[model samples]
Target chain A: MERNLHYLKGSFLKDRLFANNFIITLLFVLLALAPLFLSDFRTNLLGKFIAYAILALGIDLIWGYTGILSLGHGVYFGLGAYCMAMYLKLEASNGKLPDFMSWSGQKVLPWFWKPFVYAPVAIILSVLVPAILALIIGYLTFKNRIKGVYFSILTQALSIIFVVLFVGQQAYTGGTNGITNFKTIFGFPLSSSSTKVTLYYVALGFLILAFLFCRWIVQSRFGKVLIAIRDSENRARFSGYNPAIYKTFVYCISAGLAGLAGALFVPQVGIISPAEMGIVPSVEMVIWVAIGGRGTLVGAVIGAILVNSLKSMVSEGFPAAWSYFIGISFVAVVIFMPYGLAGLLNQIKRKIYTQKSVKQYSSAALNILEESGCDEYVG
Target chain B: MLDAICGRVKPAEGKIIFKGIKDVTEMSEHQIVELGIGRKFQVPSVFMGITIYENMELAAARKRSLYSTLFTKLSKEQMERIQDVLQKIGLYEKRYRTPAALSHGEKQWLEIGMLLVQQPEIMLLDEPVAGMGRKETDKTGRLLKEISEKCSVIVVEHDMEFVREYADKVTVLHEGRLLDEGNMHEIQENPKVMEVYLGRGGEGCD
Candidate 1:
């Protein structure tokens, strides 16, 4: 009977894993085929949404899995976007100072901009810079045991600080207009349709990779410790897991993912701006995760695409009403569907399976008892 | 005092040397735990988001560094140890369920099971029976008595009857100062204990 119960439990877990894999595959397949049906302009827009999905996945990791809500993810994303933009800007200038630097009356490239002239350095720095910053911030705050909404507030302040820094440095950064008017990336014209489609696929590929990575993390022993920390930091501390180290590491990983998303986003969207990294966009990034399902990786992707699509469609028609609509939807999601879309789907699935499982359990129990003669039963 | 030992609270003055070696007061809570000292809080503090099996897995894990935890799986022995602890705590049947499904006493037992899997050299329990009923308290007492055979068990408890039944030695404190120290019977008979703790003819104060 005990063995039978164990077998049943094992199958139950396997079934959940199977369902998760199936859904993920289906989502990816649909995305992979999207370019076939979507127009070039529409596909480019979706590529941008896919980039947001990657950013949302990062948010879900820190907030959903680790219970560390960060409202400054936009800053990391912007940093990556800026890195890619700098590289592209340099490529556009063809060995001369970028147009912005020349307009600002700079004679030579800033020392900081020189490193970004190399494509590989720019790419690596996009991811590394945010991760390093997150490590610094995470170590400072988490080591001192600062957490919960306080962490969120701190991240918000970080976003504000980055925005001000970028806006104030008009000579290096592009001031209020930000970095735009890009010509090419590695000699491919930015206006080319082929480039747009390829960028869409690239964005899609990264989103899938990010999703898998996040899933791996939340499933590992370390991931369990993350959930453990989220639930009870003191308990994890007493269990021999350092909450500060774990939190800091996960925070860095999250920031790195956001950075990757930002890098992917810049080329397709053709702009990297201070406005993108402001507190407003940072909070909106959180909203994407919240609306999809905070902890569920797939939900982040779904939520990002769905919300962005809605915004584009609705805002195009009802520009003024879009704000009111989004505001109400966010409140509605928080109050009515706290678990978000993915959680709602899971609830419905469990509701459908509950009766079937109960019957299966009782019948299996009876079979086991008959076969093994109930003698070992402790209950 | 338990908090000081667990590195949760800083001591005003004093050194806590573990096994005549490491200075526990100088370490962090996780570092002290890594040095083979585990603590059970007054309230059951199992991870509510995960399953009971996972709670045990986290406790049983020895290589708890970021890289090891992320990349490696628990060995067969560690996995078996988790199963054994769960069975001993009588939670094997509900191992897949979250701690939220557990009753108060079961949560306490689960917490104990978690500590057991850690196999700490010394276990510090704070009010392990604070909210337990008679039967649960008796069961926990038996559990701790069994655990003490393998490692040092230090319990900070106020239940005098419980201490009398289970403890090998007793120390009575009055306003953070030691009032009496001996076996349960000697402490019971001590005039100072009677004056400060038990009160008048040993009727019991707690």
Candidate 2:
């Protein structure tokens, strides 16, 4: 009993586990009913936001927990989007070269694009390619002990290189215009409202799955190690953990999650451009994780949806001032609410619980003292 | 020298043979740690952000692989081992507190406890009682004496009193070269050791 009490004291795992479950359930319920209450266009917009939320989840896993700030996540996201886009384009073209390739005078399908003709192959490649790339990059950087600002700058450079490469290959990648004007996905009309709604649900499902997966990782002993690494890499290494290998593994996993989000995103948004894979979008992705609460999985999702929603609303009204609004909000979050939205919520909950416990303990102590005084007086 | 032996730095020209085999001149720190050689830094390097118990858990992890750490739950024996170390270090009451909450000497004890949980074949502690009060230093001396019974312990310290009380054999170094080697009594009587410690030309003892 004493051991159990010891385990329970300050174990954030026990309290947050219940709260996390409740929030997840509520979120799914809201997502499931969103289609019924919203128009087709709005629902489609929400689908796109859900995709960003998935990407933010990936950012939180790497940057928030592992302390590996990757500004090159857009590269993985773009790779997955392109992979899915290739398959969709092939299905639309009926086994011929996509329109842009033919327009550019290429008579043959690129050998790399051939494997994506099969849906299963495309999906598998979409996830694996990004993971593999991340593994190689992680091995190179981490093995050399390149970390902190250096790692972030390296990732930013990667994003720029990918953007330039994608834009340069006009015949293969569709260049700055990106792959678009798709008519169908697996014989279902992409333009159909019903298809859009169905795709929205699919994106929502994947987002929840990604969130749960991240939560599982963070709760496990592995997650504790990641936090330990973030706190002090040298101390963790001295404790026998190979910090490089752990960093590489988490980096690859983060890349894979971003890839999955991009795979879903391409179909919903109907475009996968070099612009989407550039420095700005990648930095914006980090901002979402930052504003949400770096370490909290739910905070990442909330931050993504809220920031993107705010962006759309602000842009629709003023157009030129949305960037200013985003900048101010990021600064405010950093200064005033460093822990982000979830952290604020946790703080409030803790305050209330602690106050109530304090009251109960004090009152019990007073009663004991009074009874002891009465006993002494009677004696 | 402990840093060199633990592969934190490569020696300019030397080989470190442990247990009469496997020259560890080019081994990485992780490989050296795997060879049953544990090292404690001069400064207490416990993870400050985590609870002391979690620090113990990290040190007690057997596999140390990314996947195994993710899935492996601590066995009853592992828990008992951690508890034993905590009790031995007298930090069981503060196990749930972060290392930041600990006193300097407590942090030192926690690091010693971390090493003790690993149960290494050889332990290298650097200045274990550097900032400790007299009471804590005496306790540390007792602890080291107890630890030496289980494994070979080499402590690098400048505290002559601690060395005299706890150390069975002493190797004295002067200006990065071996000056004398003997028990504390013999070292006190040696002329060269005296020159290095007390007979220096009016500079005063270090």
Candidate 3:
């Protein structure tokens, strides 16, 4: 009557994994075929959401599990996007340097700009730049024992600093407007319908791959060590696990994934800017994870999708007070649904099954009542 | 080993050797932990985000191939060892539950269990009964006595009752300095220990 799970001896855990993977696989298939039926707009929108979901998962890995809320992850995301955006910009320029440079009265390309023309170099730099930044920040903060709300604030400050630097250096970074107007990726036409579709599916493939990578990490001894740091960092040290190393690993992983997401996102959306990598955007990224469900991978994915979709809808409908709507949504969910949407859905599922099981249990009691002559007690 | 370290010069300033090795200051904490000089914390530190099984697995330090740990699943044998350790700590029922939900005493109990799985030669415990009730304390005391048979136990506890029941040799520390070291009876009767642990009037622990 109570679901008969205990007798199965871990069958339920195995089944849950299988079921989750199966659902993810189905989602992948659905997404892959979506471009065939849906218009370019829907596929592009879906591609954008998938990219955002990747970002959310990345943030949640550090903020949710390790308890290190990084508001600078958006900076990492932007770095990756800027890398891709630069390559796209260079390709569009046809081996010539960007127009803005010539307009600024430059004769030759910048030395730092030469390597990014290579696609592989751009991708590698996208990952390396963010990893290096996170490494430096993580090393400094953790070494100083700067944790709790202070660490969060530090990361947020880093985000602000990155955005300001990029904006102030407009001569090279395209200023506040950032880079856009891309026409090709690895020599493929960007505006072509099929390329767009292929990019969307490619994004889907990468998201699934990222999910597998994250799953491997969260299921590993490294993950366990992260949990240890979350609970009691000092205790983790006493147990022979240097909390600094584990934190650094997770932080770098989170940043690298954000970079990966950003790389994919730049092509699909055809834009990358200083605005997208600042403190506000980073905070927004965290909200996606929070509104979905922190610490649960599916929840992070679902939350990113749901929140971004709501943003799209609300911005279209209200356009003026969408931020207000999102703010209210955040407060309501945090107050009433601590576990967020996934937790609420799980509760609803539990309730429905509980209602059915209760009815069956009552019927069983009724049979006992009839057989044992306990009708008086029932009445 | 006892004479060199008991009340002698500081460890960093002077050489104190163990086993067959002498003047061993180059060993890392991980190496020290691996080489039988085990230490436990004041708080259990039971990795709140993951399950009890994972905490045990880390303490067991028995992973086969670091790469395999990342790619492959934890084996049945690993799970069984985890369960066995959880059972030892009386926390098998809460194996899947996180430490955030565990009571203070239960966390302490879990700390004890996780450390036991490490198989340390000289276990360094800190107030193992701090935040526990009489039942939990009594159980922990018995467990400490049982554990002390195989390994030397150094319990840094203020609970005199726990000390009286479990300590084979009691060392009193006041203001970051050891005041006395002897069996419980000798420590209780010593003038300095009485002044430090007991009240100024020379009354015994309540």
Candidate 4:
């Protein structure tokens, strides 16, 4: 009887998940067709949103699932963007010094920018640089057991330091103005509408890949251990899991994903700046996860797109009141729906399904009780 | 003593010899666990977010690497072992349930079940029957007795009745110092043990 009940519960969950997957498929299809209906500018904006969605997946993996709340993801994103931008700027300069370097009176390209001239090298460095940086940071912090709000604050401080260093280095980096005026990526003119459209599809593909990657990680035993660590680090540690190692591993992966997103983001957005790596942007990245539903990969994507779209709309329509509107919405989400929008949807779905299951269970129990004639009560 | 053995606290002096190996005092908890010494926390530190089955799976002494955990599925043998432990703990029926859904006694049983899955050479359980009712306590005592047939079982418990009922060899501690080490009957009859419990004036053991 217990086995039968377990089977019933399992099948019910499978059915509900199937339905959710169907909806998600439809959503993806609509996103795929969006560029056909929208203008070039809107499509480009959507491409940027997709990049944010990818970054949001990283945040979800680290903060939502692993319980390591990093407020320095913007640093990873900026690092990746800078890598890609440096490559593009070098390519545009045709082996000469980039415009900013000449303007700042540098004789040649910086040693760091030299390797970025190769597209493959640039792409690999874009991901690896941020991943390595995150490894260093994660090693220092996790090894010391710096966690919770303290970890968040440390990440925030790292972001501040990154931004300050980048802004200060006007010669090597573009500083306040950032690296811009990109013409091509491997001879494909970025200014062309076709390139923009292609880049949009590329961003969407990466987002889908990231979503699947995160989904797989969360479903695996590794993901279970992450949730275990999140719920009780001490318990996880005693269970033979080295919490510091797992924490550092997840942090590195999260940073790598953020870097991948930023690399994709640069060509479409046409610039990479220290301002993008500021503490505020990093905090906003976290808010996207919170609003979408932390610990849910699809929710992170939805949350990023929805929040950024809303931000764009509000800022464009009412610039003066945008911050207040965003702040109030965030507060409202935190207060009224602590689990976020996706969590709210799941709760409702669970309530309805649980009601149906409860009815079925009661009828089954009644039949058992009646047949047994009070010999036993099965609940 | 359990904490020291499990490397939760350092002895500050003296070596911890385990399984004929000397000086395990500097080992981490994970290293100590790897040495086949399982310690269950007093508060029943089961992973609350995961189901009871997954908790046992995590505790199982196999393929603990990150890569293995990421790629490998539970083997038939591991699954059978988990089922066996769950059955022994009387939690097989609720194996799919999360720790939060369990009763306090059930949580204790689940934690014990977790340790059992590790197949440790020695088990140190802290307050295994602290919050349990008489029936649960009796059941746990019986379980521990049965478990002792396979390996050594050391239980740190405050319940004198429980200690008297299950313990074959009892060691009494007072102010972090060993007061007496003997059979339950001997310890109960000993003046030092009586003085430690009775505080110089009480009539007898409760």
The model with the greatest lDDT is: 1
DockQ score for model 3: 0.41
lDDT of 3 by residue, A88-206 (tens): 89999998879777766777888888888899999888888888888888888886778889998988888889889988877688878888888988889989888988899888888
Pairs clashing within candidate 1: none
**DockQ for all models:** 0.88, 0.66, 0.41, 0.73
Fraction of the true interface contacts (Cα pairs closer than 8 Å across chains) found in each model: 0.98, 0.59, 0.54, 0.76
Q: Tell me the whole-model lDDT of each prediction, alpha carbons only.
A: 0.91, 0.88, 0.77, 0.88
Ranking by lDDT: 1, 4, 2, 3
Maximum-DockQ candidate:
1
- In the range B1-206, model 1's lDDT, one tens digit per residue, is 89999999989998998889898889989889988898999989989999999999999999899999989999999999999888888999898899999999999999999999999989999999999999999999999999999999999999988999999988788899988888999988887777765475455433
Error of 2 at A264 (Å): 0.8
Model 2, B80-190: lDDT tens digits are: 999999999999987877899998999988998888888899999999999889999999999989999999999999999999999999999888899999999999999
| Residue A179's lDDT in candidate 2 | 92
Chain A only: list TM-scores of all candidates.
Answer: 0.95, 0.93, 0.89, 0.94
Clash count, one per candidate: 0, 0, 2, 0
lDDT of 2: 0.88
Better of 1 and 4 by lDDT: 1
Residue-wise C-alpha lDDT for candidate 2, range A296-360, written one tens digit per residue: 88889989998998998899999999999999999999998898988887788778666765665
